[model samples]
Target: MIGLLSTTFGVSVASALLPLISVELFAIGLVLKEPEIPWWVLALVIATGQIGGKLLHYYAARGAIRLPRFLRREKSGKSSPGRWRAWLESFRENCRNRPVWAGSVLLISAVASLPPFAAVAVIAGWAKVPVSTFLITGFIGRFARFGVLAAAPAAMATWL
Candidate 1:
């Protein structure tokens, strides 16, 4: 769980750093667009990073035993169940005894894929969502969001 929380934090921090990364990513391509990182590329990177982070976060939160001691802190005070229970409860409300856990997982996954809100994945994991379902839904949700981000600039570039 500690690893998952860290992964979530790291991913959030990464998302926050993306604009800076975008500058570099576009610079690497030697593109002269005013926006250093092309919107599509930025979106793709964000999507990919978040998806990977979420996967790691899920497994880490799932009590994967292979993680090293530094990675898995069984101690309390930080990233505790009580600390995050509210968020988990909020997420569960949406699930609300839904017949198909997959659907709930998809919705939660989509919510978590959004920047700044990706931490929701940790809460979902703590809720004991099935790994396979979580991964598939998360991937699709992240991809869909990236698709929107990728298409936005192309659609709006005419105005810019």
Candidate 2:
């Protein structure tokens, strides 16, 4: 059980940090292999791992940590801002105007991955959303998401 939990947490964190990895699929497989592990326990472990991994991006976006040169955005010396920069500026302004909506978007992305949770985490931090708010909403949303995902295999087995 300890080994399974550790593996779950490791995979969850790795998936969170790497866009190519899919924690959702991993959770499904884990459930199929270890039905004895409680679904909620799996959910909590995954949520903690994911949020912990994403916290690095949040901290970087919030300027608590500096990104290395490769990850940092290069300044465009052009007289006018580029299209992406302009759009980002506009989006930042909108987030500033409606704080609740910003938080809602973060929660929605965490659960549904509509806009991609990785980007949302950075955006949430860049927009100055409180760290406490980010962690609370992120964990709740991830917990809910993984809870359903981890239970899917058992649900399917019973139905079959």
Candidate 3:
């Protein structure tokens, strides 16, 4: 049981890191095949793994993880910042001023995947949302999402 849960956690982290992987599909399939594993246990494991994985992007965006030279933009030799930089700065500043709004958006994105949770995770970190807030909010949102998905197979079985 420990080994299975550990594998699920690792898979969840990988899914979080790799865009091509779908942890939702994985949780559903796991539950369908191994109904003996408690749904809440799966949800907790997946949620922790997901948040742990997303921390990479969060730290990278926050400038803690140094991006490679190729990923970094070259200076344009212009005195003024580019329009995109200006916009990002503005957005970041707005988020700093309205942390609750930013956190709410992050919560919404994590749960709904609207506006893309990956983008939001990077943005949230770049915007300087508190680390505690980020982790707590992300965990809650992801837990809710995976909890439903993990339980879905059993729910359908009961219904059908």
Candidate 4:
């Protein structure tokens, strides 16, 4: 149980920090092996850890914009804003313009493997989406995602 908890936490953190790694895949492998941990419990733990890690990414991205270099040169007069600043500004504006769409996309990214949850979390933070919304939607999506992954192996085993 301790090992399972540690592995879940570590995988969640890695998944959030590294976009290329798929937490679902890791969970699926564990679920297929049918460890001593209960599937539902494992899913809940994994989802919770993933949400925690994603929240860290979100806050980090949100804080990054506050840096002096990210500010408009006209306003700060300290450093010239570059393409990154412009792109972020445009992306934020786009998100602000279509909040519902942006939220939907973020939710989908959390549930599905496409588009990468790390990127979506960072974008959502940069877009200034409410943290509460991010947490709520992220938790629900990740729970469902992990649940599906955990169940798939069992279903496949039954089929075999």
lDDT values for all models:
0.53, 0.88, 0.87, 0.78
Model 4 whole-model lDDT (C-alpha atoms): 0.78
lDDT of 2 by residue, 70-137 (tens): 98889767898889879877778878898788778878998998898999898877877888878988
Query: Candidate 1 residues 35-146, lDDT tens each?
Result: 4445455445545566665666666665662678776667567554674567667666655565276355565546453433245565556566666666667666665665
Query: Which one is best on TM-score?
Result: 2
| Residue 95 lDDT in candidate 4 | 80
The segments of candidate 2 whose C-alpha lies over 4 angstroms from its true place after superposition are none
Task: Indicate the TM-score of model 3.
Answer: 0.90
Q: What TM-score does structure 4 among the candidates reach? A: 0.75
Residue-level lDDT tens digits of model 4 in 44-140: 8888888888887788778753535653334566477899888878878878888777777877988994687878887788688888878988888
Q: Which stretches of candidate 4 lie over 4 Å from their true place?
A: 20-22, 64-90
Tens-place lDDT per residue, model 3, 1-160, is: 8988898999989988897898888888889889999889999999999999999889988999999999886867888898988988988997889978877887888888887888888888888888988998889899988888888888999999
| Model 1, TM vs. native | 0.52
Best by lDDT: 2
Q: Write the candidate numbers in order of decreasing TM-score.
A: 2, 3, 4, 1
Instruction: Score residue 44 of candidate 1 by CA lDDT.
Output: 50
Candidate number with the higher lDDT (3 or 4): 3
TM-score per prediction, in order, is: 0.52, 0.91, 0.90, 0.75
Spell out the clash pairs found in candidate 4: none
Model 2 misses residue 65 by how many Å?
A: 1.0
